[model samples]
Target: MKLKRARRSRRGRIEIIPMIDVMFFLLATYLLASLSMQRLDALPIALPDGKTAPLPSAAPLTLSIDRQDHIEVGGHAVALADVGNAVRQQLHDDRKVIVAADDKATQGTVTRAMLAAQNAGARALLIVIRHEG
Candidate 1:
């Protein structure tokens, strides 16, 4: 003969708070990672709209033309006349140059900037434009 004994039952549980914390961490990590992966080569300005194209793989020189007609190369202030020289100095082997001009910039200024870069030996002159609707 044996004595009867009481039994205890164990129930598995899922912690919701920890799971939510992990998800938030993952979300923040992905957001930061994506932001880091982007390549920002030029200053922020109002760009015009035009046909779109893929960016070149090689690191290209950025030439920014503000609405006030001020020119900058690789984040450095440069004169309009010195644009060619600046391009020649900063351009890589791919000869890729990105021209970012403001939407309010004069047509002549943009044209001259493009020509200056081209004359400086930029084989791939990519003009940055706004995305079409």
Candidate 2:
């Protein structure tokens, strides 16, 4: 006598739960990797230290000077002669300005930029320096 065999049934539907988990893991991994690769926009420099003070409520204008003595007002490059005018245009009622100078930059260049900020009617001037480690 021949025995009869039963065939198992199979479902063709796709499983989505595992795929969603894998996608989430990949997204998290990429996010972490991207964060590690982020960089600061300001030029690296050694800064002087002083007593910490509260920042003003209004956003202050940023002026940067690189080692090469290149001057930038609010991230836009400007000639030394035009620094004052550029600063003036950005000044509002707050009239605050922040100057960041590279450690290798000459004192003369930094002084000139500070003077320009003053001439532009900056009521408050703040120098940005790296905190001593």
Candidate 3:
């Protein structure tokens, strides 16, 4: 009469909280698909409506304009008398300038591209509307 058996050795585990919730949902879906594939320097306008503001913190300088008026800045092809020396060589220290015309552009080429971004010092001249809602 020989009967004595009892063996249960469970081993094999790797849960890490659902692998850290699927690596935070694939890092939040690769940061919302790389922030919706960002890459819009400027140009391609039709904006006019207005009332939106609030967008500083540096990185403004766009200054586009189309409808045959031509002229550009950050996207190159600038002329209109060198658009104030291409907005003073893309002013740094955050002079802040946007413009982005072309709602049939020609209020004297959007007021001469906002007076050439205030003669290039551009103390701040944002103007790229289109919100009227």
Candidate 4:
């Protein structure tokens, strides 16, 4: 009896289970990371109602924070550490410091700068805001 040759099969189909699992794991990781991030501060702000009194000093020493997060005093960019000294020096007799911060400016910068101005002996701290237009 002649020996029958066994039929040789080609390469078996590749399993996609591992690839699918990897994709799923990566998707889950990204979703979790995205969900874990905390949103920016949106604290409640109440505007003054009724008759508003004028500031003690009409003209105030201006500390501006642009969108780029640069600190400027009296139209001059000043370092964060030097803000207090600069403000004080600029306003020898003045008692008010007005903070004009862009909406895109970092909150920490504005807050810290304000504190610095106060520490530098600003009699009044006025918070000013501008419209996008």
User: Which has the greatest lDDT?
Assistant: 1
Question: How many collisions between residues are there in candidate 4?
Answer: 0
List the candidates ranked by TM-score, beginning with the highest.
1, 2, 4, 3
Whole-model Cα lDDT of every candidate shown, in order? 0.86, 0.84, 0.82, 0.75
lDDT of 3 at 98: 79
Instruction: Estimate, for each residue in 67-94, the C-alpha lDDT of model 4 and write its tens digit.
Output: 6778888877788999999988887476
How does model 2 score by TM-score?
A: 0.66
Clashes of 3: 0
Output the lDDT of residue 38, model 2. 84
TM values, all candidates: 0.71, 0.66, 0.36, 0.54
Candidate 3 is scored at a TM of: 0.36
How would you encode candidate 3's per-residue C-alpha lDDT over 11-76 as one tens digit per residue? 989989999999999999999999999977677878888788667565677888888888778888
The sequence of per-residue lDDT tens digits that candidate 2 reaches over residues 9-106 is: 88788789999999999999999999999845565566676556656676688888888888888878898999999999887777888888887889
What is the TM-score of candidate 4?
0.54
Backbone clashes in model 2, listed as residue pairs: 47-130
lDDT head-to-head 2 vs 3, winner: 2
- Tell me how candidate 1 scores on lDDT: 0.86
- Clashes (backbone N, CA, C under 3 Å), per candidate, total 0, 1, 0, 0
Q: Residue 43 in candidate 2 has what lDDT?
A: 56
